[model samples]
Target: MSKQSASKSNIPLNPLAFIRKYDELWRRMLFLIGALIVYRLGSHIPVPGMNPERLAQFFDGSQNTFLGMFNMFSGGALERMSIMALGIMPYISASIVVQMMSTVVPSLEALKKEGETGRRTLNKYTRQGTLALAFVQAVGMSAGLISGGLTLTSGLGFYIPAVTSLVAGAMFLMWLGEQITERGIGNGISMLIFASIVSSAPGMITQAFTDNLNLIVILLFAVLGLAVTAAIVYIERAQRRVPVNYAQKQQEGRKVYAQQQSHLPLKLNMAGVIPAIFASSLLLLPATMGQWAGTSANPTTLQSIAQNISLVLQPGSPLYLLLFAVFIIFFCYFYTALMFNPSEVAENLKRSGAYIPGIRPGQQTKRYLDFVLNRLTFIGAIYMTIICLMPMVIQTSFGVSFQLGGASLLIMVVVLMDFIAQVQAHLMTHQYHDQTLIKSSK
Candidate 1:
């Protein structure tokens, strides 16, 4: 109808066009790329004092266990015993601890209610926690390297330097992730993890192909990969829309506006890849401890217990699968609850004079929302469980070495979707700004 609206409607929706027009968006994208390059480079810089041949031999032997998975997440940094061997796990673990504490700790809960300032305080605590964790893990890793004969030099002299290097590297990575979040595109931590997984892809694929060398098997895996990717994209986009009607109100000029209808979009997987990551990290702890115990010449009672626990929890073990699914389901509900508070949402809706159809404004709305969320979480948990277990199942059944399955696949797919969504959002915002400028000029 109007010239402004007509011109706006004619604007191209193409991503390339937006990138060409918006210098800031392109700059952010470049920054993200540069940050990822730095991370990759760090992943290749091995820590000093380790014998490269012995380290490589150790990882080669341990490739099927928890260490392998850690290596995958670190973009081969663990196998290389890189300066970044610790990767971002310490930060993730620290975040999990902080978030879990927020539920039970009154002070933290109060801080949470304080908003941005509180968030900053909590983040400071998380970084401190990360540093602490990095120190402990670095000590363990350095000691392990010495005990396993992977280190060319031994004693406190070697240990001290190695530990310091790992801890410093981890802290640097944490800082890099934060900077990317502030100055680049997409979520920085997730993007880093995504980059790690993707960096390992070419090698994994080549190894798998070499091991199998069956054209049929290769084709089958290719088809399955495509299918899984499609499934992930479809489910990630799926959401349940809860309709709400806002009551009409009179303005300063005494003009009454008509009631407005809108919908709240609740995603199927509100927790995203967090639950899976949490579950995997928890599962890895016992296995890692067990691996360390196995290296001991004389084992104590505690070490024996740890070894038994690790044996029972190998990746393809029945017990491992069961516990993994349970943890995933538990975290799905736990994290979803933390992220989306039904009571808060209901309160906000009520304050805005909005109501879900056939539901009362406050308590009833909360109850209904909780019910919907629980059901959705249940389905999401099942979906995540299946996706995560598929790799193990395929390995056990088909004897295929499909390393890039399950949690890695989910992270890659989800992060990619989020990245694309962020890019599109920037493009749309730029287009809107351009339309406004055009209207003003007219």
Candidate 2:
């Protein structure tokens, strides 16, 4: 037993053993790596008629603004004005909008119940929305370039082609992400974002060193990072398992099934990193407008108001942080409510003859579940708020510019945990298949 336990413990530490044993796992992993490589390669290809040096300079000064966050999501593509500067944000935004609408729109709500076919239809709609968003954003970026004097050509010659390139790049990424989801190991869009964050880490570290940060400060930052990562893992794995009991039942042939015990597991963080991402994306809208408005030689009154709004909401500012927290908390409850329905769970449990101990089935069970979930969500909102704000606090205190923000770190850690979980699931499926084969042979 001791030897078996030791071997099992070592499995995760050395994934190479599993890679060698599982052909499908390795092939999927290889495909994922190749797709990310393709994404990184595209990040280096600058758009036509844009000044790369000027673009880099602009981003360098704008690192404290929303543009910096945008660049980070693009794997530094925006810094170079690369073809993929828009990244897959348009798709993400479209997805969020579609999901919100699905709850309110009767047609979409009905489609949500149609299973796989419905999912395909919604994905088509998301793609169309992505296309529209990408075009609008690309046009904005082009106009910003012209206003900021970052473009080589003045007229429609540069505008049309630049917008086309940006839109195409975004669409390509959206397609690539979908392919990865179907053919690769993890969720394609998340994996792409993970790759982007990781690819940019070395540069961030190098920049820290070049900034003459003392060893002690660097050590402190490293310690904080490790602490945050550990906390994330712990909280992510935490769940409240509600005990359930199934009553014995008899079939027509006098066959009786024994009573069964089970659990309904409620995650501490039902929303994951989505709240942070959504809040950031929403906030970027005003900031992007301000960025363009500020560049104009003679700004209109509304533009000036936008510029003022942008100033108040610049990343790391008190107002920005407050709004960020509010949005994160709001979306946490909103998304959790969207994804989980206590009434449905209660109904399903009642139908299956399962009931929580000491609690009546149906409405009572739903109310209990709702109470539990609300408390869990409240705790989760606070936890996420801290995790997403800690890095900014550290940066402000130390006066050090750490390229990794709280949101970025949370996304990276959560995505990696999810990837590992998927791998483990695949492994279990393969093992189950092998065992079935052995049983059949015997």
For every candidate in turn, the CA RMSD to the true structure comes to: 3.7, 5.3
Candidate 2 residue runs with Cα over 4 Å from true position: 1-21, 252-255
The alpha-carbon deviation from the true structure for residue 250 of candidate 2, after best TM-score superposition, in angstroms, is 2.5
TM-scores of all models?
A: 0.93, 0.92
Model 1 quality (TM-score): 0.93
Positional deviation of residue 175's Cα in model 1 after best superposition, in angstroms: 0.9
lDDT (Cα, tens digit) per residue for candidate 2, span 374-440: 9999999999999999898788777776558788899999999999999999889878865654454
Cα lDDT of model 1 by residue, 382-401, tens digit: 99999898877777676665
Clash totals in order: 0, 0
TM-score for candidate 2, residues paired by index:
0.92
